[model samples]
Target: MFSILIAGRLPQINFQQVSETQFVIPISDIDHVNHLVVFMTGQIPFPENYGGGGNWPSAEGPSWIFLGKITNVKPSAIFKIGKIKDIESKIGSSLAPTLFSGFQHQTAIPTDGLLGISVEPLSQLDQQIQPHDITPSTVASNVEFVSKMLNNFVNYVTSFVQNVPGTSEQIVPLSIIQTWYNNFQRRITENPNFWR
Candidate 1:
């Protein structure tokens, strides 16, 4: 991924393309990634950026809506491993597939119930890499921010069809998502080689 990326642009494209013949990358080392390249084959850019162009007809008209279109991405297990200093365990090539998401939801139920895991405390990891000069209010905000991230990640992982029997909406545990995140951080710190 980085190989193709480095061949393209700069910070706009985070990759380390060596030559035409070789491109080495460590596997599953990163914990998070922001505005980074997800997939890179031969410079064509794998998935489509957005499906059907413009956001016209604010009101629902006689149009073919893309209901649950993006079922899954190509490369299966996402996440290449690597750390970028302050942002340890950042996402790498493995996450390249997810970059295509935009206005979507889970269609198929998960294989496991996220294994029913709990959100392990990452305070130790936090202590190891303390954020700089945080204010008192920032503490609360940061916690809330972490909570939201956990929320999104939870929504991502534990998506399985479980009938409520009474209610219309299905259910999935957020704790499992939290666990995934915690484990991800642990893995990133442990190996720190998925994305070398």
Candidate 2:
């Protein structure tokens, strides 16, 4: 079990392990955002020379999330944007962004985590991750990527509230957005995994 806190609102979210290190936070439990935040950590020990099927664990996490995490090692995040609808044609989903985290640095041992989701470029959220020395430009590139992603997210939320059914023009507070932005900055610089 772990507690996830998003900046501004939706603090101290308790999530259960769906499988290994992967935990799914249902949208209903959240007051903000509409999609599921899929948090996953720990590295699966794939064979040194991965051949095929049985070489990997049955409970493998999402490929992009896992591979991206392992390669970078520094706690990182990405988002996936999509809509959710029901058979009855009702807005069964909030069309919110899904946040996913990867562990700190590539390591054989399982490790720490971060937050985010989507097609945004994979970004290292923590700098103190050891062994792997990422260049300053890489860090800058990641920051630029995340900054753009956040802007896009804000725009998506704005458009979604105006057009989605049953949705009131409730906007995610700017303070919250700033908080989220700051939170990422803080984590990247501080590497504070509240879990510890």
What lDDT tens digits, residue by residue, belong to model 2 across residues 72-159? 2222222221111121122111111112333222223232232222222323212212111111226765576667766755764565
Root mean square deviation (Cα) for candidate 1: 21.8
What lDDT is reached at residue 110 by model 1? 32
Global Cα lDDT for candidate 1? 0.29
Error of 2 at 35 (Å): 7.6
Top-lDDT structure, candidate number = 2
The sequence of per-residue lDDT tens digits that candidate 1 reaches over residues 1-196 is 2221222343223222223322223212123331122233333322333211110010122121111111113321122112222232243323212111222222132321000001112332122211121112256665866676567665667575366887897776667656777876775454433222
Say which candidate scores most in TM-score.
2
Q: After best superposition, candidate 2 residue 7: deviation in angstroms?
A: 4.8
